[model samples]
Structure formats: structure tokens, C-alpha cells
Target: MLDCKPASTPIEANHRIKADMGDPVDKGQYQRLVGRLIYLSHTRPDIAYAVSIVSRYMHDPRSTHLNAAYRILRYLKGCPGKGILFSNSRHLSIECYTDADWAGCLDDRRSTSGYGIFVGGNLVSWRSKKQSVVARSTAEAELRSMVSGICELVWLRLLLTELQLYKGG
Candidate 1:
């Protein structure tokens, strides 16, 4: 997709991946592309959700998946230097933001829970994953996401305590 038109965004917010849509394509190439995207997502959180969506089709990809992969490539080419930026900021604080979509998955009707954690104003941890349990209501989905974030917060708190790095009460 070197000559393809560039996309401003990696993935469209309204686009959803469907397992049973489109014609089947080569699995090997699709998996390889997804693998590279996954690796890229490490520092480019902007593409994390998009990469996660495309990665789900590695087992059996189709034309639509291939097109999405190409779109990501175009996005990457548009801004090769696009990634997280961290500096030596003295301001330190443990913060996390979380959100969930009620039955967002087109295939399973599963909700997607996403979170981002920052330590000292630097992004340290983030996730865009589908929930294991099927939530019956929007409130339930939101609570499930909150629970996940709380678990991560508790773990980080314990870790900070063990390291004697934080003294917050």
C-alpha cells in the first residue's frame, strides 16, 4: 500500500469487524501483517484499538480485513514518526482512564473495555480488549470495565508500595 492514499486515522470509529463478512483471503500474510501492527501498537497507542480489531481476523481473514490492514499501512506511512512522547517531567501521579462499549462486537455481541494508565504523566499501560462475560446491560458493562480498571489500580498500588516509590495515602 505504498502508493495507496493515506488515511488520517488508522481505523474509523464506526467501522466494526465482522467474522462472516467478505471473501476469504490468505491467512499467512494477514497474520504477518497483524503481527507487525501489534508490535507497532506498543508505542503508538493511537492505533492500538485499530490494531486490536484487525488482529482478531488473523485466524481467517477476508478481503475486508486485507483492506483494513492496507489502510493501517497507509496511516503508518503518512506519519512514520507518530508515537508516544515521554520526557523527564518531575510531576508524578498514578492515573487511569477507563471506558466500555455495550455489546460492541459485531460477531459475539461482547462489550469492549479500554483503559489507559499513566505514571508521572507518562503513559505506562493501556488495553483495548473484549470482555469475557457477556454484559446484559449498559450499566453492567460499565461496571465490569470499572472493575477491571480497579484491579489494575490495586495491583499498581501494591507494586508502588513494594518499590517504596510512592507515599500517597
Candidate 2:
């Protein structure tokens, strides 16, 4: 795909990954591609959410999943130099935001939760994953996401404490 056209975005906003959208494709190759994307997401937060969504189909990837994977690759190609960028800042503070797609999954109706933690206005940590339990209400879904974020915050605080980066808990 070296000569393939690259895309500016990893996936289209309106795109959906239905379980039975298309014919089944090679599972091994699809899994490998998703694995590489997962590794890349460590530093490329822009693609983290998209990669997480695509990785869900590793067991039985369809042609649609393959296409979505290709779109992510194209996105990387278009923005070859895109990655984490840290700026010089004396002040550091942890600010978190969380959200959820209440029962957004088309097949089993599992909600997806996401959180992003920013340090001094720059993103430092993020996650996007399917919720363990099905949330019956939007409020419940949001609470679930907030709980995940709080866990991350607690861990971050502990890490900072161990490193002596923060003065107090």
C-alpha cells in the first residue's frame, strides 16, 4: 500500500462497524494489523479510539473491517510525522474528561467508554473500550466512564507520589 492514497482522518465520523456488514476476511492478517495499530496508539492518541474500535473484530474480521484498517494506515501515511508533542510548561495539573456511547454497539448492545487525561493542557493518557456491563441509561453510561477515569487518576496520583513529582496526594 506504499502507493495508496492517504487519508487525513483514520475513519469517517459516520462510519459504522457492523458485525455482519460484509464477507469474512483473513483473521490472522487482520489481527496482525490491529496489533500493530494498538502498539502505535501508545504514542498516537489521535488514532487510539479508532484503533480500539477496529481491534474488536480481530476474531472474525469482515471486508469492512479490513477497509477500516486500511483507512487507519492511510491516515498514518498522510500524517507521517504526527505523534505526541510535549511543550515546555512549568505548571502541571491533571485534568480529566470522560464520555460514553450508551449501548452504541449494534450487535450485542455494549456501550463504549472513553476518557482522556490532560497534563498542563496536553493529553497524557487516554482509553476507549467496551463497557463490561450494559448500561440501561445515559446517566449510568456516563457514570461508568467517570469511574474508569477516576481509576486512572488514582493510578496516576500514585505514580507521581512514588516519583516524588507531586508534593501532596
Residue pair clashes in candidate 2: none
**Best candidate, TM-score-wise?**
1
Model 2 residue 160 CA deviation in Å: 1.1
How high is the CA lDDT of each candidate model? 0.87, 0.89
Question: What tens digits encode model 2's per-residue C-alpha lDDT throughout 36-130?
Answer: 99999999988988898898888889999899999999999999998988886766677899999888887788889999997777788999999
Model 1 C-alpha lDDT per residue in residues 49-114, reported as the tens digit of each score: 888889888888999988888888988888988788887777658898989999988898999888
The whole-model C-alpha lDDT of candidate 1 against the native structure comes to 0.87
Error of 1 at 25 (Å): 0.5
Whole-model alpha-carbon lDDT for candidate 2: 0.89
Per-prediction count of colliding residue pairs? 0, 0
TM-score of each: 0.94, 0.92
